[model samples]
Target: MKIIADLHTHTIASTHAYNTILEMVHYAAQAGLKAIALTDHGRRMPGAPGDWYFQNLATVPRRLEGVLVLRGIEMNIIDYEGNTDLEENAKNLDWAVASIHGGLMDPNVKPTVELCTELWLKVAQNPMVRVIGHSGTPQFAYDYEKVIPEFGRQGKLVEINEHSFLVRKSSVPNCKKIAEVCKKYGVPIVVDSDAHFCTELGVYPNAERMLKEIDFPEELIVNGDENRLYEYLRKYTKVLEEE
Candidate 1:
């Protein structure tokens, strides 16, 4: 189960992440990846890049280091209402991954399973959202039976983020559960490194392991097939048309 493109990765523009865009692209090229997304954290996260950084992504050529570079943002989901911190200007990016981060949510709100389910359902309907990032964290488990199907209907890729195993191990059980439901519903999924550094680009051992365990259908994995990924990009984004 090899992925030709990693659709969620971070660069030094994300502050906490350690390498530059070129550096990350270099690693992707080295890994023989066909494409990679530079999805920096949105402004709501502490030290996250500002609007200018994301809005000006046009300057970063679509092709870099012999790899297709997807300019994107990992926006922070801010409330149970499913409002994200994505800047208006960054809305047109080639890709977007909306996720709940412990540090960025409303401090006053306590997330219940029902509330998280509602939030994700709303996010699923969001046209701007391309990928549902690392959902069903231990603390943010939603109603998988209901929401996963909606995600499928909305054409949102449910991410099986490899980074969760390394940094958010507590979410592993829920991640497996999400994958099971995804397979049952025949929902398309994306496997991403969610890397914070160049060295981590195209790394997906954990996500691949989980998918293999459940015998998840390979054709349903967008990043696993280059032509399928290009078709998806051309369908929902201006990527191919940009030429």
Candidate 2:
């Protein structure tokens, strides 16, 4: 299953990420990708960009290097109540990926399976949240059976983050479990490189292998084909409309 677009990539704007937007887009063009999203981290994460950074995304063209460039942000889910660190300026972005990152939440507040489940359910209802980033982290594990279907109903694309396999090795097992439940519920999913560098863009070997193992339906993968990717953008975002 080849993905024509990668909807979760990072750039130098994210600090920890190494390449610039032009570098990333140039790589995508060379890779023959039809689209890519520049989803920098929200302010809550250490060294993450500030409000003006997101508010000024309009300056970035909708298309770069003949590839669709989605102005996006990966906001941290800060609490069990589903509150995220997304700034008001983020409303102008073309996409938003919400995820629970370790150390971003309160230290004293423990996360229970029930609380995690509730948290994701609430996030699923958020209109601005289009992608659910790496929900397989063991520490933030939630009810896959209950939450996957809700995500499908709310039109949220569950992400199969390739970076997790390399960085958060422990989440592999849970990630597989999440993929299984997603297949059972026919929930749409997105495979992303979650790349921190230009060369990493559009790379999805591990995630693709995992999904193929479970025979996950390719049609349900939003970025698996160009037609599917465009359909999703047209239906759920103003990216195409503005273009």
The estimated TM-scores of all candidates read 0.98, 0.99
Residue 146's lDDT in candidate 2: 94
Over the full model, what C-alpha lDDT does candidate 1 score relative to the true structure? 0.90
Model 1: per-residue Cα lDDT over 1-243, one tens digit each: 689999999888888889988888888999989999888999988899889999999898999877999889998999998999997898779899999998777778888889999999899978999999999588888999999999999999999999999989999999999999999999999999999878887888888888899899999999998999999998889987894
RMSD of 2: 0.7
Q: Name model 2 segments beyond 4 Å from true.
A: none
* TM-score: model 2 vs. ground truth: 0.99
Number of clashing pairs per prediction, in order: 0, 0
